[model samples]
Target: MTICKGVLNSNVLFYKKLKMEVDMRDQILEILTEQRPDVDFNSETSLVTNGILESFDIVSIVAELDDTFDIEISPKELVAENFDSLDAIEAMVERLSEEE
Candidate 1:
């Protein structure tokens, strides 16, 4: 049967789809915390050209996100203007996950 907006899903497929955002958020937090243990985990995470993260970190994060969520992050979306802060990253993840 088809479900409407905001309808709770008990099906397996629906569960996986619905949980993607929560999983992405947790994974992102885990990665950021592990990479920058000295930084304030609760505070904002600015990863773009602000320099908090280097090329390597970005590569690793992108890899992890791709593998974990099975979502392909395009180069155009990788710009500093788009994936700068944690909020921005979360937004991107949500958007990509939704598209999937």
Candidate 2:
């Protein structure tokens, strides 16, 4: 059954999983926002070599991914295709979820 908390009705047990996705996207956006302060991050492909996100930023993103989502993204998975866009990243996350 759905439970109400204040003005919200959410399944408490699933909240963390839900929030993790939200937090991941926010963290990604924040990282990009800080690193590429002048670029239009919303529409471009995020590649380290493209100067959109540097290798250092990718390392930070990896750490955040592990901490925020309990997802272990390996070095082998650090392909340019994966970080091409926000849409690609979201699709990867969905694929990972299914694999688990």
Best by lDDT: 1
What residue runs in model 1 are displaced by over 4 Å at the alpha carbon? 1-20
Q: How far is candidate 1 from the true structure (C-alpha RMSD, Å)?
A: 4.5
lDDT of 2 at 16: 70
Screening candidate 1 with a backbone cut-off below 3 angstroms (N, C-alpha, C), the clashing residue pairs are: none
Worst window of 10 by summed lDDT in candidate 2: 1-10
- TM-scores of the candidates are 0.67, 0.59
Q: Which residue pairs clash in candidate 2? A: none
1-100 in candidate 1: lDDT tens per residue? Answer: 3575336555666889669667777887787667667655456556667687777777777777777777899887777755577767778877887898
Tens digit of per-residue lDDT, candidate 2, span 1-100: 2335632544654787689777767766676566557766568875544767667777776676566556778798787777777656666665665676
Q: Candidate 2 at residue 84, lDDT?
A: 71
Which whole-number lDDT from 0 to 100 does residue 1 have in model 2? Answer: 25
